[model samples]
Target: MFNMSGLDLMVIFKLAGIGLGTTLINQLLKKTDAGEWVFYTTTMGIIFGLLIVLQYVLQFFEAVQTMFTF
Candidate 1:
């Protein structure tokens, strides 16, 4: 009873990639002495990822409203 279109899968993959990349970058920065930048990097990554998902979330709500409306 679940539907996942190609676009949805792509967004999921994109989020996964962002998480992986951010983790790697954070580790690299921590090893170097740029620990301060790690927090910003992680925060930006989360914000970016949420922005990517937000579009779909809004669309889902719109779809539900449309489906329930006469």
Candidate 2:
């Protein structure tokens, strides 16, 4: 089962915020002449998501090291 912890929830909230912000920006930019805003927001979201994943990945590696080390 995928149980969520406080830190997990926080990460989810942060990612959701990023997605919502990007969506809002994309919607607003759709009116003007700049059609590339959607792509910009999408790339930004991907970058932010990757950053968050990397932080958790580092934590996971540290935990594994601590567990295996006597």
Candidate 3:
């Protein structure tokens, strides 16, 4: 439903990197004796995931606009 010619494997790699970074943060926090860090780590991960997903949302809106000639 959207033009994905500009999207490629690199995007997937970036997302994976985000996930890994979040995992590392979680692990590091878990080791530091700071329980609150766990919540922060999870929140950061969710934010990052949402940011990545937003790209697709923007693309979807663009596709719809193009289809409607608006």
What 10-residue stretch in candidate 3 is worst by lDDT?
A: 1-10
State the lDDT at 24 in candidate 2: 82
TM-score, candidate number 1: 0.83
> Which residue pairs of candidate 3 clash?
none
Give the per-residue lDDT of model 1 (tens digit) for 1-70: 1234736578879999999999999999999999999999999999989998888777778778888899
Ranking by TM-score: 1, 3, 2
lDDT of 2 by residue, 1-70 (tens): 1223636578888888988988888888887767777898889888998898788777777777887899
- Looking at model 1, the pairs that clash are none
The TM-score obtained by model 2 is 0.77
At residue 47, candidate 1 shows an lDDT of 97
Instruction: Give lDDT for model 2.
Output: 0.79
lDDT of 3 by residue, 1-58 (tens): 5768757887788788988998888888888887688888888888987898798889
Runs in model 1 with CA error above 4 Å? 1-4
Using all chains and alpha carbons, the TM-scores for the candidates as numbered come to 0.83, 0.77, 0.79
Candidate 2 Cα errors over 4 Å, as ranges: 1-8
Positional deviation of residue 2's Cα in model 2 after best superposition, in angstroms: 16
RMSD of each: 3.0, 3.8, 2.2
lDDT on C-alpha atoms for all candidate structures: 0.86, 0.79, 0.84
Model 3 residue 30 lDDT score = 82
* Colliding residue pairs in candidate 2: none
